[model samples]
Target: MSSNKLSAVLEKQIHHLCLKDFPCGYGTWRKTKDSTEGAETEDTDDLLDLLSCRHSPWRHDKSWSPQAPALRRLAVLTPERLHTDFIYNYFTTLRIVDKGVSVIDDGLLRFSKLEELVLSDNKITEIPAENLPSTLKILELRANRLSALNSLTNCLPPRLEYLSLGSNSLGSHDDIFHLTGRHWPQLVCLDLSDCEFKDQRALLSALSTLSCLRTLVLEGNPFTLAPSYPGFTVDSVPQLSCLDTSWISAEERQCFRGLAKNSDLIVDRASATVSVGRARGIPDPLMRVEENAPDFPVVNYGYFITYEFLSHQTVNLNFDRESKSDAANVIEDDADLQSNRNCEKESCKQLMVYTEETCHDVTHVSGHSTSKLTWSECMDFSHTHTYIVGDLGGLKRFFNKGLYLTIEEEKVLSWPAASEDVPLAKPSRPVKEKKSRKGEESPIKSGSTKDKSKDKKKKSVPELFQDAPIRRILGSVHIPLHSLVTGGQKVLVLCNVGALQTESEVEATQTLEKDLGKTIKEDKKKDKESKQGGGSSTKQKNTAASKGKVKGGQECKMDVHTDNSVSVQLEPVTVEFNVELEKWQSASEAHQLLLPQHNSLSKQPVLS
Candidate 1:
């Protein structure tokens, strides 16, 4: 309230408080003023001494009917007293309380440079935006008749930031936006503490759009009375860091987001982050490629055959004793091959090449090609991640090495043999032969074995491993089979993962050990016989030298016999891969045993 410029609306006489030439007030209504004292009235429509104009006080009240006398008086005195061009440039602020200023009439608009205007407890119904000065910033229109905010949308000063429209019926989202909208982009703080609104939803919906809002006061409003109101407000308006007097903290936001149910009155963040529309009825990758795709041409066909096929193709087909042409036709017709000449369609053959015992790279879809898979591209929808937890021994035995485990192996590995009380007995060592005092050798038995073998039935991929402590396996999840670009080329692969052992694995191991023991016994007998034979041969040679004598130029001769034998044992380890709806079949039977049976954390209502 600096008095740098005087604010006076005297009666018929001017005050002589200082020099008679002191500067005039905010509005120079009259050159002269009176010192007569008067009491204020209750009815605001009644005229007061706020202006020097001589307009009849009775004329201000439009409700007064039969206004013939008031109109007659206003026509004569207005020309001599009221003038619109007299700009009140001296005063920076003007405070007039209960002055009966029903409208933003000529008395206030004359202050073209007015910065601060407080028109409290008045009958001012509305102010047209074009009448106010742009230089005005702080506007206090509290306890006034201003109910609607529509008039103040652009009427306020362009630089006005802090506005107190409190205690007014200025409610509703439509009215609220008149102040919070683009017209008031620089408004960082707003005071609508007691303002009325349609509902909490309507209010929050309007406030959420103002991304620039930093502080808001809504304490006395009806919308702020709900349970978890602080949470709802903070979450509904992300930009609002402070509400009323309470400061919104990171911990509060984290806590209230889940606890508050009203926040989802609008699902904005979900709609913004992911496009759920794309995931609906999405086609599988394998379906896009035809099952009977023509093989791609190999430019260097002869080079491929010589290096890739001819060198590797050592197996001989035992065709029946028939014509050459017939045998050729029979070979081509055997394996459901499109054509025997088409070698490019060799992926199926290679699929069953690696067995459980022989693990290979899972990355390699072909000898020369790798699988194409990026996590983001493959996971088009929601996903659940699983962490594997089991013994290291279980995992080591689970996988052959680098290849994916076969279905049987995966089943055995997944099921725990720990269900059985008896442990698997260790293999016995072969008995060593006792050498005689004479140091004689024994004859060795020839065991039959064959190698150039045909592909046999695939053995179980999972191996029996010793029980160990829990080994946490992280990032283990079943990828939907359709997502793979290998065209549904999935195989039983061995992965060294700690997992439960099954009854099948235990039974299979017992059978294998029995077979292995018989083989070991036969090997021991062969070695013992071979040693005895060597010992007898040496003894005979010694006797021949001692009993027989030879003439002086005759060379001594002796026959030393040795038996040589070769054996090969071939094991079957190949299996057929079904290609019909392979993707759907794998997904339907995907692993679910490892998933947690109960998740209390997921059911929690708030973030800890």
Candidate 2:
């Protein structure tokens, strides 16, 4: 057939194939003209038979050869027939290529229209800089052996946004810095999280220049712990809005409090130990505000912290939508001020120190903000002799030795009316009923009334001493005496002999009693020696009688005389009691009372 006729037939077949569904097993055939001159000595019938043999309309076959001049305009080609001419013309917009094709050095230029080039998960490692089309926006070369980004220095498109070079053996930040400057100006995100960097300074310098960079994820890098490393400070890079430093898990929002001032950056131990204020080279901003004001607003009155919400017009502070209405209501409520005072008193009932049993509201007593530690204000008193706060279930776990006491408890214990000699009172007794007197009761009224009066006096004296408020009990088994001493708190351990049970308790009681007796006897001897060298037997007896006697296994009922009108009766274990004149007197007395006695019976025996 003529060249013009063959070209027309080829175009018709190509058009038909293009319209059909892709990868369809369809075939077409056409005849090619002989290139050699004077070779057509055969018959027309022979040429027709050859053409008929090459043609098959229904089945796919490679009859229309791409090398033929008639089929040169075809855009797509198979891997076996990928020629330079085919790539230059038809594959102009092609951005993706499958494996098994070794056409890397094609001489075509200007692939500026392509956006994404996904050559990832492939064996192609080295990319020639000049070969890459400038129009390429994304180059995904992840999971390949890319030692350095030097190859991409000249080829990196300015508009490249996302570059995933993950899982590659890219060594250091210096290796990747070759792709910096105008080459990657529009690049906003870079994932070099797990890439091994010998020094982060290169990365830091490179990142410092990426003014448009919004997010940076640096995790699993060894140089992250290196010293002299200035972290991602917000002040240093104003455009860096988000940074994942691996200090906390990604799931937590804004982990690690107290970032460097004037910068959103967090400083760990690897960084310089500089205070936020000092690092910023200014006094604390909050302190400056307070210094400007005449007086700092009072948060707590007495024992309770109260927030006074003035008129909404007075304060022009802005709050989030959720809290705005509530904030306004708080300011408008006039009764809240009065209720706050009442809350102060009522809230004291729930106040307690840490113990074995968990006290959830101890955080409240410790003065933590409510938003930080979310717990009910009410104290759980079900667990005996124990308190807890937050997740700590024991008092020992919660508090280190410190003088912690509720305002009310402190006031009651510090009363001046409490006496050391008077015994503590038991709880109040139930009321008694008066018996009705019938007709004969009037005859002997005076004698009966006198007898009743005497009985009442005897009963009242015991009741008064027995039912008095217990100022302090020293040797109660429920209370941990050793814990109090070892927990770093300075406390007075007062023991009463009456509370002793076992032989160990008795020995402990006797040891305390003998020490008290010895101290009293020594004082008396010193007094006698001071007054005169010699004293009469009667005078000695009188002096001995005047001085209080110290006894073992007996509870001393002392009336605690304090400044307050309410008198407390203190029942000390195993020894006579005396009022503490000075603050340190109690501690000194306890120390003296714990001294070992000489006699075996008076000495503290070994406890089983």
Winner by TM-score: 1
Give lDDT tens digits, candidate 2, residues 276-336: 0000011111211222332112111111111111111111124455754443211122223
State candidate 2's TM-score: 0.28
Candidate 2 lDDT score at position 81: 47
Off by over 4 Å in 1: 1-87, 154-156, 258-608
- Local distance difference test scores for all models: 0.37, 0.34
Clash totals in order: 44, 42
lDDT of 2: 0.34
Candidate 2 ranges beyond 4 A from true positions: 1-104, 107-112, 224-236, 241-608
Predicted structure 1, TM vs. truth: 0.30
Q: How far is candidate 2 from the true structure (C-alpha RMSD, Å)?
A: 32.7
